[model samples]
Target: MPKGEGKVLAQNRKASHDYIILDTIEAGMVLTGTEIKSVRKAKINLKDGYASIRNGEVFLQNVHISPFEQGNIFNHDPLRTRKLLLHKKQIKYLIEETKTTGVTLVPLRVYLKNGVAKVLIGLAKGKKSYDKRDALKQKDMKREIDRAMKER
Candidate 1:
C-alpha cells in the first residue's frame, strides 16, 4: 500500500498537544481474530497507550481493543499487550533513541492498510507547560490570521 493511506480506526489526539513528536514510523500489529474484528469496527483506543522494546522486540502496551460482541467465549482480552512488527534494524534504532532521557515511544494512531492492521508510532519528547502554552498561542495566531485574510 502507498504511504500514509489507510482507514484510520483510532487516534491519540492528545499526543500532539502533550508531546513534541520527532519522527514517526508505521508498524504492523499482531492481533487475534476477535481483536482484529473489533479493530475493524473502530472499537479501539490509543489514548494512554505506548510502545516499548522488550527482549529485542517491540510491544504495544495500554492500547484497548474491545472484544467483538459476537466473539462469545472466543473473545480476546480487551487490554492485552500486543506485539508490534518492525524490522530488527528499526527496533535497534528505537531502542537506542528511547534510552535517551525524555525520549519515548508513543502510538499516534491505528489504521488498516491493504486489509492489514498498522499503527503509527512516534518518537516523542515531553512538552513542558510553557511549551504547550506557546503551541496554543501559535495556533490562536494562525487562526486569527486566517480569519483576517478571509475578511479581506
Candidate 2:
C-alpha cells in the first residue's frame, strides 16, 4: 500500500508512558456511519480512551470519534462507549489476566487494516512515579548519546 494512502487515523502515545504494556491485541470497533466518516477524515482521539470487559464483552470508552462535519442532529456522541469486537477466547484471557494482576486494558491505537477499522488494545499495568522518572532519565541519556555520536 502507498504511504500516504495507507495512513494511520489516531494513536495513544501516552499509554506507553503511563503503563507497562504486557500484551497487545487487535480488535474491530462497531462504528456508526457518521463516526466512520469522521474517522476517515482523521478526526479522532484515543489518548484518554480505555478498554474494559463487562459481562464477558469488551467495550471502549472515552475515545473521541468526531462527528461528521456534514451531519446534523444525527451525529453520534464523540465520547460514547463503543463496543470492541474481540474473540471470545481473547476477551476471556484479558479478563483473567486483569483479575489476577490488577492490570488494565487501554486502547493503544485506532487505525485501518486492509480497509477495515481496527483498534490496537494493550494489556498494561500502571507505572510508579519512580518508573516514569527513570524512563525520562533514560530517554535523556539516549538523546545525549545520539548527539555525541553525531558530533564525533
Candidate 3:
C-alpha cells in the first residue's frame, strides 16, 4: 500500500456475498481518544455492522471497537452506536435512495486515512438464494480456469 492510503482496520467480507453493492461512499467516524487507539491496532469487527440515517444524520451500528487494554478507566464502549460525518447533501441522497424497497446501507470496511478513521459504506440490494448459488458457481468456474492456466 502506498502512503496516504492507510491500512484497513476491519472488513465485513460477508456483505458482498449477501448483497449486490450498487455504490460506495467514504465517511469519517467520530471516535473517542481510546477508541481511535484501538482502531489503529485493528481491534474492530465490521461483520455485523451497518449504517443508518437517524435524525437527519448517519450513524454506524453494531460495529465493535475493542477497548484499549492500557486505558482501563477511560475505555470507550465497545459496541456503542457511532456517528458518521458526511455532508448534508450526501446524507440527504442516502436517505432518499434507501427509501426505495430492497435497498439498504451496509458498512463494507473500516480504515485509517491520513490519521483519521473512515468507513466505506455501500448502498446494496440483497441477493436471493439462487443468485448466491449462481455467484458461487461462477467463482468456482473462474478458479478452475485460473488453476488450469497456471499449470500450462
How high is the CA lDDT of each candidate model? Answer: 0.94, 0.88, 0.92
What is the C-alpha lDDT profile of model 1 across 1-152, one tens digit per residue?
23756888898999999999998988999999999999999999999999999999999999999989999999998899999999999999999899999999999988888999999999999999999999999999999999999999
**TM-score-better candidate, 1 vs 3:** 1
Q: Model 1: residues >4 Å from true position, as ranges?
A: 1-4
Can you tell me which runs of candidate 3 are displaced by over 4 Å?
Answer: 1-4
At residue 81, candidate 3 shows an lDDT of 97
Backbone collision count in every prediction? 0, 0, 0
Residue 23 displacement in candidate 3 (angstroms): 0.5
Q: Would you list the clashing residue pairs of candidate 3?
A: none
Ranking by lDDT: 1, 3, 2
Instruction: Compose the digit string of candidate 3's lDDT tens values, residues 1-152.
Output: 32465888888999999999998888999999999999999999998888989899999999999999998899899999999999999999999899999999999988889889989999999999999999999999999999999999
Residue pairs clashing, model 1? none
Predicted structure with the largest lDDT when compared to the true one? 1
lDDT of 2 by residue, 65-100 (tens): 888989998899999999999999999899889896
Candidate 2 residue 114 C-alpha distance from true site, Å: 1.4
